[model samples]
Target chain A: MIRRGGRRGGVVAAGLLTGALLGLGFPAPARADPEADRIGFRSYFQQRFPDVPAEAWIDGMYAIDEGARQQWQEIEDFPPYEFTVEEGQALFQDPFGDGRSYGDCFPDAGRGIRQRYPRFDSETGEVETLEVAINGCRARHGEPALSYDSKEMLALTAWIAYASRGRPMAVEVPDDARALAAYEEGKRFYYTKRGRLDMACVDCHGRYAGAFIRGDHLSASLGHPTHFPVYRLKLGGMVSLHKRFHGCIRDVGAEPFDEQSREFRRLEYFLTYMSNGLEANGPAVRK
Target chain B: MRDVVTSALVLAACLALPVARAADDSRTPAVEGVLAAVESLRAQAVTAGHEWLGTRSLLDEARAAAASGDAARALELAEQARRDCELALEQARREEEAWQGRVLR
Candidate 1:
């Protein structure tokens, strides 16, 4: 009887050991530490490209690819976005039907303020994007909201981005539960795999940054938000950040969230926060 | 006379089998059932916020096939859509916890 009991005890111990070994394949629950995450995120890229300075990330693929940089410099010389910027300036100066201009709705007359976007609204318990704020301004002045992808909207954002050319990204996640939740949700969205391709944002931008996909080199996620509302030669027009997000999602075989939707807004909030110190360099040209 | 009748009946039965099989080829009810299942799965995937880009287009194609009386084609498209939704939902479930591991820290 003693020998039989010993054998049973040995079997139970072996089962427990096997279970523990299998558990190693799964991830442990991570503690929420935004600062630590930011440090690790920056460190990964810094280590990957030891030659590139941290600030140079704002130039995106141009910072890494020498050939692309030369071509981009040539394009910048004759900046195609000049016309759009002028149109945006005209729209900004023109008064609404209510005799109030777009400047009447924003602080600093809406100049040099692109970096303060994707802000947390304490009252609404949600993230508010620059586009959403622009629409809010329109509504207040009894004007119709522009479509998120409209030429007018792109022009306005391009001008705002141009105005704040050298300002650093200053997105802040307030010390509130809702704000933290939004940030966490956005982070999850960034890492979560979706679509037929089963790829996440991190797979391309994080894991394979500076790598060539066909003719296009993938840019690091570190300073992705800094240069947006970009004029793309392929598109022959200006494209907003959210529009790029839509394209990325679709490229991965995932249905994208609507432009300026809650999901995209939260994503923008989280992404902008990741580039907190990068200078805003938008209304730029791209391939 | 009885033998002759039996032979004729066997020939008729064999001929009728093809006709019955032809009717089964356009099984509209089967296509409808598959489409229904695909829709339910698609809804779950959409709710989970992991719907694939091709799922909706496949579902639309299935509906068009069904309207055009191509039951076999409709069922094929619906099944493809159903598989897409199932994979998306599985992805959603796996990523729910797994995403934390991919975080930079």
Candidate 2:
């Protein structure tokens, strides 16, 4: 269910002109249908890169770039994230002071559940990301919440992601008004220009996906959330999806929201939903 | 008469120097006011979730400049920061509707 009217043509023309004048980039007039949005979003990328298979989007930039794909295939031979995944597995199984572990709070002992994250918790009436859930679990059990950037949190997410590899992304935008509003807000955040650079997420990932920006290929937004807790060669460490969001926001000259912040959680919710059928292949390597 | 004229000019110049310095010192309060304006706008931007990077830093730098008695520099930085905040607020408002256009169909 979409909340806004689908006015077309003139709105698009005016939007383009305004965007050009503002240097913020153009957008289609608003549509509120979540399923339609997902389809349109996916179709845009699919049409743009016909040769790439739908499932390959999990590879991100590598899915479209042949040379980079070859290099990435080689990197996969000896994935740098191996140790982190092991560490995460240990952390996952380690019990809290009450002798109950992180796995106790999640379904299936927290195995193979990464794809269902950034869920809309109706009770809280807010987007509850896996990170938030993890922290909440800690709070409920009388344990201190781990910082989003803490090694233990990163490791735990990495292991969970590893466990969920190959499962398709399954984020849902419930029919409730608050849920829809949250989704809409996330969509707006993706397109809206913020920061000193005056660039929106759409400007780079939508308008210029597959284009080289300073020798780095911009990945399509379609499968952005399929992979997370990526080990970046540049950072020589693992970073969760929200951490990546924070960095991208900062890169655009905006003051970033905190990790697992409501803004970021909403963003993750919208972004992950866009990749509804893409397989989760996290704890992946990136340049 | 020429010597008298030269001495008179020198004395006048000496007296006027302090007056000029006093006038310049008076600008400190004006710069502080600009800094305050920048801070207010920055808070608004932050509230709107549109605060730009470097705005806070610019405000800090302006305060530092004011503390160091560089009224001109302080004014310049404060004005720049204020402009940044204003632009951010404008962006936030513009995006309210413009974001719809950017959505994928």
Candidate 3:
């Protein structure tokens, strides 16, 4: 199933070399221009699907898959994630044994703030995901931190993402050197080939995006951040971003990184930034 | 005369082929040693928290081959598994630093 032919080895090296050369040639040297990358990324997808509106991409492959789009539309009529969202709302309001609530931990009680997460915390010199921030709040409140890939965490995130629905993704890769380094690290992770399959995220979702792999259509990476904590019918459960990352890595035969690992946090940081300006639509149903 | 030389060459190659095969057959199989090396690397990968699934599958196949008494096949598989695990370990190490080189500008 691993397609090895065409555009594998030298393409990655060429990209790296080109970037390095460009960095050296620039007057004010910077490792990357997120703005330029954003323009290019959006343009590529736009050119690929001239008819599909930018906002429609939040639906992922359904933007391209007509049949799946119909099914997804039907499924969304009575969304499967409603129960989980209700549970998340209940959990959010429920106070810890210490008598404080999840609201106290976040700005605006975490309302409409999903866009700002996976932020570079200058204090910690690491990317802070929503899951990490949630657990941090729990620990501070003398409550147990939930597992990054647990149903509780997913439910909580689904609620938060629901709260932020229609809010644009606004993740920042801060100007700090540490933050920049983390962003670059995430960019590297995205492009690097691994596993016996020797595939990078770019190979499928980047280059051959919209191309079919067996029965599944590869979704472009641009709008990946829009819909998350998705209710996957195949999985018959909610899937967190970290869980999806694990599955994708394992799909290519690579060892899955630990959930909420530094590498994963960085990846989330980069990916969410890529989807900046896209409206958050979560607790989404997916096939 | 040309035919005679051609015939002689063929006869010589035929004689040498079995000798080479016999030499290969005479050497001690390296399967056990290679399998051990692969297992060691697998343990290291586990400690590093980056064990590759392919490494385990290849090692399992090598073990099965060994159990079936196909030393040559076992040796080949074991050597492959060893190389795979070694590469996996190296990948984990190299990415620690090499990731920086690929940052998009």
Write model 1 residue lDDT over A1-287, tens digit each, in one string: 88999999999989887787667565555445566677888888899899998789888899899998999999999999999988988888889998998899776766878998889999889999888888888999999999999999998888888888899989888888889889889999999988889999999998899898999889999988888889989989999989888999999999999999888898888888888889999889988
**TM-score of candidate 2 relative to the true fold:** 0.85
The TM-score obtained by model 1 is 0.85
Per-candidate iRMS values, in order, are 0.9, 0.8, 3.4
CA error at residue B104 for candidate 2, angstroms: 1.7
Q: What's the distance in Å from true for residue A284, model 1?
A: 0.8
Residue B72, candidate 2: C-alpha displacement in angstroms: 1.7
Docking class of 2: medium
State the lDDT at B53 in candidate 3.
Answer: 66
Instruction: List runs of model 2 lying over 4 Å from the truth.
Output: A1-31, B1-29
TM-score of chain A of 1: 0.88
In angstroms, the error of model 3 at A4 is 63
Pitting candidate 1 against candidate 3, the one with the higher lDDT is 1
| Per-prediction DockQ | 0.60, 0.61, 0.19
Q: List the residue pairs that clash in candidate 1.
A: none
Candidate 2 structure quality by residue, lDDT tens digits, A1-287: 13233456667878888878668655655446789989888888878888887788888899888898899889989999999899989888888889998878888867889999989999999999888889999998889989999998998899999999889899988889899999988888999899989999989998899999998899988888988989999999898888899999999999999888888888888888899999999989999
